[model samples]
Target: MKNIRNFSIIAHIDHGKSTLADRIIQECGAVSERELTKQMMDTMDIEKERGITIKAQSVRLDYVKDGEHYILNLIDTPGHVDFSYEVSKSLASSDGALLIVDAAQGVEAQTIANVYLAMDNNLELIPVINKIDLPAADPIKVAEEIETSIGIDATDAVLVSAKTGVGIRELIDAIVERIPAPSGDPKATTKAIIYDSWFDPYLGALALVRVFDGEIKKNQLVKLMSNNEEHQVLDLMYPHPLKRQKTNAIKSGEIGIVVLGLKDVSIVNVGDTITDAKNPTAEPALKYEPAKPFVFAGLYPIDTDKFEELRDALNKLKLNDSSLSYEPETSIALGFGFRVGFLGMLHMEVIKERLEREFDLDLIATAPSVVYHVYLTNGDMVEVQNPSELPSVSQIEKIEEPYVKATVITPSEYLGNVITLLISKRGMQDKMTYLNEDRVMLEYSLPMNEIVVDFYDKLKSISKGYASFDYEPIDFKEGNLVKLDVKVAGEVVDALSIIVPITSAESRGRALVKNMKEIIPRQLFEVAVQASIGSRVIARETVKSMGKNVTAKCYGGDITRKRKLLEKQKEGKKRMKSIGKVNLPQEAFMSVLKMD
Candidate 1:
């Protein structure tokens, strides 16, 4: 146990954390050179294509230091703010962490946020400067910035280029010398925390755990502390990149995978505690708290008959991604669908894409919205996730929307543009600090609704892809808000409804109706598209009817005969317009997002 080190790699997106992880695994000789791959820790196809880590992965490594064998358990964590929950769980299972900073770009918003999470877990941190081979690399300046901004002693910060494999040997030595080994009683009752869980087709549900006390052996009956359910451990194995190695027992202070031979992954929930059923421990290793979703959106199959297939796909996907939550809902415009909850916009995008690719289903996602707290005149409050669910304006007293503390770090040149963007999104400045001569960190309190749309994309574009942003939910605050509903040819489409602040409701309604006019197909009769707030219409657009030659056959007839034919055609159009149904294309549903 003294030679064992349990740690995780933490950094901002595109800061060489994944590259550093690849280098470390190579140095430890975990995989052969012929089979080694880039971003080995990121297993998903979407992750590889996008160059991002969506899920946290772990691997065990063996190293020889000074002629002594050492065991290292390394957890590679996601850097995006959406997957911070994954980082928190990974940090909880680690005794130390390696903080990687880009030599060209010093501390970032996510870097500071993750540092706080590591600090809360009381994990030892090792600062490492990466990308030192780049022409713009400045390790000394970054070290000083880390010291001032993060308040960490970076005098001994390791300088290494993860891309070129420099300083890897010395970094491994530092991990062995600095990071403390796991400490727990091997003779005590079995106690371990399930840091991660996933479903396997052949093996059923598997849990990656860190044993704190005693040992978990094959065929042992273990009880889950969260639900008091017991299951027999069918197998035990240590984690690796290419393949997992079989093991008979997982001793204390070690990380390994436990197989329960169950079909459901929910039974082996993440953050849950596992202990011996007969010799139960007095307390759990860690308290379990499931992730809370902040964004809600409706996902509907393009083919309404495939609703059941969508449900089945969701269930299977949930086995792999436990953060996803959904419930059955029906929309008048889109028919039967599910109202899904997501951690953020990126998470919602990834899940939607996965369902379409993995299950071979066509899906349409509604505009994402945040949870709203609506207070009634009778002193009662109701939570609203969908715009259609909001009570009538006459019955409601006030509405409050969720807000978050947004942190942005950008170059000095983009400070004005970043501030302007934030202000346009209804963000209130909180504080600003100068991290260095050329970088500034700005903090603001922004509504969660604004961030869920296209805030990240706009930020990246405005900053020229040189800024990093992170946010945490703060609280709900009262706002002058109203529910905006869309009417197509006199019928309300529930799926097109959205909530907007009263101050900007008029402009938003105008923009929405104008965008919808271009998407709604022209029918034989004129279609009136209207946007309204309760009973008042704020904006309206007309899709002119397709012209037809009603009097073309009457060549030399009297003028009165032509007039009679036109009159008859007008009457028929009036009747058709009353009973006509508009078929809204997928683009019409997505038009809500394009509303500027």
Candidate 2:
């Protein structure tokens, strides 16, 4: 039998996990030069455009070394905190993980968080300190830190560079030896987990799965446990880095593709386990939960007319990302905007960037929100998705909000500043230790809702984007912050803003109106923008039109140019907001840029 191995690469955000993934697939002899592109696992346009692995991807490579064929099942996982649930699911299909760390940055908080997940999954850990060829790399120090922090001996940590292909061979050799071989009963029952999948405009739904046990064959009947959907597997194939080729079926230890699943990509659960219905196995499915959506906001288009178009784009995106949830929501104050939930603030930005960059859409978003539990006097339990629904203390029995255990790793010089900033964000330090002479690591217990909103971005800004932080859900605690009312045009707009400390009511109101002013268009007629805290105006601004200042003006032989300009402006006015008879372009809504 050919030697079979299953593994995955886990690391912090931007630590070259996807890049290392490409190198491993190539070394497996699955893909070739002409057939390969950068970060092949990140096959989606949004994934490539954003430089983040949004989904977990599995690829099969056939390696021939010393005249022996080695079947390698490689699962590429998302490194960002946003996709923790998906990463945990990817671990379910793997027997070991290559903990790729940036040698220069040493061990980061995300690295530690992922390590804990791997340990929880009972997956073997192989520390592979990547980017060793970088100028700032201190392999020895990183090895020592890994030993001290992860409790994994540093002696076996391999120094490798996913960029230059350095130490790749040794890394592969270690995989062939250290990682355990597949031993599950191939004939017991069919079970596999869909690590990641995509919808082909041509091929339908293509799913990449790692067979945990039994076997899956082309044209065989299969069932998706999450939704209980059954389908006939139309085809099966393995990764041909150079060219795709059809495979008959894959055994328990193999990883490959399945198609004609019929169900939409969203129905295919990433962390969900699959098994044969007739001979179902009792093995508990891999223990992993979906990444919690922390950040909340509204998404709207510059041309409210194209609101449907933007919704379609998001629907297409959500087909692949089941974790992203929303419903048709209208804001009496801000007009119609969907209340979006995200894993974190970066997750929110990534969504915005994709909407703008990939689909070529313009969008405006409100401040993010954290989920809150509201308990009523009648014993009714409600999970408040929007901050505006928070019941007053007098009306509620109690409230609970999500909490997290967080860790921050940064240079020693910024230790004091980091702590001050974290404390300001309602983070309480539990432990602080020096990693070496130049670095210090701090562990804290914080509200998950905080970090998922703007805590990550704020921390990076305060630390010059040098500090790395990672967190896992700890528990829930009652919060003291109250929801700030954002009213426009003298009406309460619940979706216009969020929950904030009493002291920040003014600043939050100011920021919201500022963003609206910047994004709201300049109408022909003047429009007043007032950001108030419960009828108290914190800031006010007015958008005044140009008032046909350049209308019908022509001198010399410039008539043709002016006519073209007027025609273009007319089309633009059609796309902009209209107040009375005046046309307001989309850009007028955003007034903060002018202030900046």
Candidate 3:
């Protein structure tokens, strides 16, 4: 029998996931008053810079009660909707989950999502309605709402102010009581879940696992069940990478790190299951499935000439993150650009930010487009990622659309208004609950097709930024939405358009084109920016004028400063790919591009 337990802390965005982690670590004696960074789990520069958890992080805490210590393995996961797949994978590794619903916000989309994932994994779920110390907190109502909605009794839900460390003791006790201790024969073959994995400059590749069954120690031969690949373990450790926690063995349900320096670290993927080869365990590792990228955009180096460098940078990015999907694609009009796929818009933005921060390379992007299903003749089914590739009316049979399951949380007074807004957006209510007399829960099944353009911005606007929602691809249904393709200089730019509602096509395209105009940097030549509905251009922007004349009259200013200035200008110009006399800038493409 094992005394240790493993649990994950999951919640909606900004629900204090990192904060609660801090208090838990402190209580476990992992850190002292003088030894902790703010949001220690978020150690990555990108994570701290964005104020979000982009990766799943693991930590081990030794909790003492009456002089008896119970080691608890705690893994913190990204709470954003974009990282839902990562959340699901992390949940797969845990025996239970701590659903940290915000007291003031009650349950948002991710709250429902993380809970659903835990239930699906068949893991024990202990709801920790957090932020109780906040003046706006309403733990009682949150518990009631959770019970009424998910059918999980929140009657005993632990209320905690993770920030103030209030009620943390109770929360820890609840974890030990609610979650099952790790089980299975310690002498048998080992099987573990890769909670998180990343590349290390010195160590090569590192994999963090919670041994669900048997034992794994240094010199043990293990196989990844998913790929049927064998690796010889060279070392073993616990928790943080900085420490070399060499252990002879890890028994069933013990969380630890295993290193296999012999194998190519690149193949050791996160979410993979590692098991001992001897006394083979019949049960395979837990399923590892990456989320499909919903948002599509074009990635082009601004220095139009550094195409190879851009590709290499993306390759390096893919090595670190398994989520990014990219394909070699080109625009006859825009020249060379990559069709990069992302889980969502937030994901795209995060990737852009990372590239800018890390690569120091300028990138240009077009607008994001939704995945479209175009039924063709001869019983052929096609998924159109770019609008310019949409089948002509002759080739297309019936078009199907993607949908999202959304949850809306707001004040009771705003309930009617929120529903009205969703109804207008062609969303159907799936479920509802009363958080309190003053707050309500509203669930809706919204079409993903409708949300392809400006739906998120509109949702924030209508709810006055008080509401939070998330969605996953549910099913495809017949819809009236059609693809609007943008054409620049008579050449169709596939990355420049999106699939949107017929009613708002012209208006949305017009507004987007306006945003694109503001975002797209000026070029050496007068370039045209256009948003088109199919082949017809609905909106267009013409560069007003160029400040410089083609003839440089070649002799002015200090020779050295001018030479330095020319060198800098040349280097800057090289960062952007020049297409048809236009030098595209990275800023123009990263956030708001007219291309895909």
Candidate 4:
């Protein structure tokens, strides 16, 4: 175990985490040159196209240092705040981490957040300055910034260009010399932590685990600590870039994949402990806590009959993304659907897109909302995920919405714009500091609801994409909030209902109705798109009826005859308006996101 080094690569979004991972894999000769591609660890097409990492991946490497063979287990993690839970879980499985910082960008909000996470895990950190090949690169300045802001010694920080493969050899040598190897007893009872699990059609569910105590061998019956269930290990393999390398046993201080040949992925939960069923360990290998979802949205199939298919898809997807939670729900506007909980907006988007692309399903996702705490007059409290699920006004006492502590790092020139944007989102200043004369870091407390929709986009736009943001949920606080119900032709569209702060209810209602008017297709009769609170309509917009000239045939008739035909047409429209069902295009449901 002395020659074994396990480490995770972490960084802010677009700070070369994945590229650095690719470079390291190349340097260690994990994959052949003919098979290697960019972002080798990122297997998803969406991740490739978007230039982002949505999932965490691990690979075992063999390296020869000074004529000694060394085993290096490297885990590549996502840099986006939405996938930070993946980073945390990956960190928990590692003994050290490589903190990658952009040479020109210096430190970012997510960098600080990830540093804190590493500190909490007590992992040895090696600061690495990437993008040194760029013309504007400032490795020395970034190293200083890391030491000042992150309070880590950066004098020996590695300077590498992940794109051009500079300093990669030195970085690997630093890892071998500095990061501590895994320490556990190979003779102890079998104990392992399942860091990740996903479904495989041919192999059933596969768990990628780190062995902490004993060894996991083929045909060994193991018990899951999360549940007292026993399953024999059908196969064991070391994770690799192109194909898994078969192994007979996974000894202590090693990471490998265990196949139990079970169809149900839930049984192999991430963070669960696997121990020898006959001589099980006394306790779990690590203390595990499930991920908590912060945002909620409704996902409905366009074809109601495919509801069961959607459920099946969700179950399969849950195996890949365990953070996702869903429950059955029905809406007047939309038929049977599932109310899904997500970690953040990006996560919601990725899941929806993946469902559409991979499962071949047409889905409509309602406006994302945060969980709200509704207290009743009788002193009963209920948690509300869907706005339409809110109790009647008469039964409610007060409403509390979740809040988050947001950290933003931006250049000084955009400080005014950033502050204005935050304040407009009902943010309260918490603290502020200057990372240097030109860059500033601002902290704010903002309602979770405000940031769930388009805050990140706005922040990026106002700052010209020079700022980085990250947030963590703090607690729920009471707020003067109201539910805004949207009505189409006198019928409430429960799917479009949203909870908003009482202060901006009027403007939000107006903007929503206005946006809806543009997206709602014109019907044979006029449709009144109204935003209301209870019985009071706050804003209304009319989607004008499609004109049909009934008097065209009587062009030469008397004026009274033409007038009579027009009157009949008006009466027909009035009758149709009462019963005509509006076919809300998918864009109408998504219009809620564009209501600025």
The candidate scoring highest on TM-score is 4
What's the lDDT for all of these models?
Answer: 0.94, 0.74, 0.75, 0.94
What is candidate 1's lDDT per residue for 1-596, written digit by digit as tens? 88889999999988988889999999999999998999999998999999999988999999999999999999999999999988999999999999999999899999999999999999999999999999999999999999999999999999999999999999999999999999999999999999988778899888999999999999999999988999999999999979999999999999999999987656777888999999999998997567889999999999999999999889878767778899999998888999999999999999999999989999999989989999999999999999999999889999999999999999999999999999999999999999988999999999999999899999999999998999999999999999999999999999999999999999999999999999999999999999999999989999999999998899896899999999999999999999988899989988998888
lDDT of 4 by residue, 1-596 (tens): 99999999999999999999998899988888998899999999999999999999999998999999999999999999999989999999999999999998999999999999999999999999999999999998898899889999999999999999999999999999999999999999999999998888999999999999989999999999888999999999999879889999999999999999998767888889999999989988898678899999999999999999999899889888888899999988889999999999999999999999989999999989989999999999999999999998999999999999999999999999999999999999999999999999999999999999999999999999999999999999999999999999999999899999898999999999999998998899999999999899999999999989898788585799999989999999999988789989988888998988
Question: Which ten residues in a row are the worst by lDDT in model 4?
Answer: 549-558
| Model 3 clashing-pair count | 19
| Superior by TM-score: candidate 1 or candidate 3 | 1
Backbone clashes in model 4, listed as residue pairs: none
- Candidate ordering by TM-score (highest first): 4, 1, 3, 2
Runs in model 2 deviating more than 4 A are: 34-36, 46-50, 240-242, 261-267, 277-288, 301-316, 333-337, 355-363, 375-381, 391-400, 510-528, 535-596
| Steric collisions counted per model | 0, 15, 19, 0
Off by over 4 Å in 4: 555-561
| Tens-digit per-residue lDDT, 498-572, candidate 3 | 677778778767776666567656664455677776567888876543455322655666677666766765555
Task: Summarize candidate 2's per-residue lDDT along 548-586 as a digit string, tens digits.
Answer: 645556666767788887887766655543424323333
TM-scores, one per candidate: 0.97, 0.84, 0.86, 0.98
